[model samples]
Target: MNIQNFSVASLLAVITLSGSPLFAKEQTQAPAYEYGMPLDIAQAVRIDEPKSTVCEVGQATMTYVDTHGQIRHVTFLQQTDACAIQ
Candidate 1:
């Protein structure tokens, strides 16, 4: 058995296994051209029913169904309420 080679490999394995934040700095940096935005805030709300339509108010788009099961889409100037459905 090669004792020297076994010891050297064990030392390297220990160093690599210890967590180091500095080693991950390069991975955390965002690219130059790519920008970040709040994806949850920008998502469009869809209400499914029998009748609905699609409408575009601004950047956001909403889709829903009317009383008669007609699909409709509408955009809002401002988001009045946002609550997750249970």
Candidate 2:
């Protein structure tokens, strides 16, 4: 009936239809990988399920999903030299 009431009603309707919280509308995204790691790591590392992956730069371990949908873990470099392979 009034301007204040109408504003609130309009905002509620928009939020309800969107099915997401108002805070979500201006959501901030997290870093692709854990902190204290080189920026290149995020770009080079691959993960099947980014959300499920557990990246520990200090431990040099990265978890991801395989092609078969199975979870897998890999290290940056173990015995074999990755650069040599390339």
Candidate 3:
């Protein structure tokens, strides 16, 4: 009986792990950034913003890799265009 129970438990574990998202073929998108949200960034990948001659408020995007090695991007408002000249 004990051997049979062990076998059942092992089988269940295998099934659960197989169906888990960790083993999933599809990758889900990361959550959008918010105020005071902590980000575990491993490395930056890219940045998207408008090009202008003067400072302006525009939509900006920052692409980076999280600590889990997953690629993610955050979109927010930022000052784009050329740098301020002294």
* Predictions in order: lDDT: 0.44, 0.47, 0.78
| Per-model TM values vs. the true structure | 0.24, 0.23, 0.54
Model 2 Cα lDDT, one tens digit per residue, 13-75: 987878766556435433344445543232224533222133322224455554555544444
The runs of at least 3 residues in candidate 2 whose Cα sits more than 4 Å from the true structure, single-residue gaps closed, are 20-86
Cα-lDDT of candidate 1: 0.44
Regions of model 1 farther than 4 Å from truth: 30-86
Clashes per candidate (backbone, < 3 Å): 18, 0, 0
- Candidate 2 residue 63 Cα shift, in angstroms, is 19
The digit string of per-residue lDDT tens for model 1 on 1-86 reads 69999999999988887746556753453222224522223333473222213332223344645555554454334322321121
- Model 3 pairs in collision: none
* Candidate 2 lDDT score relative to the true structure: 0.47
Error of 3 at 71 (Å): 0.3
Give the top-scoring candidate (TM-score).
3
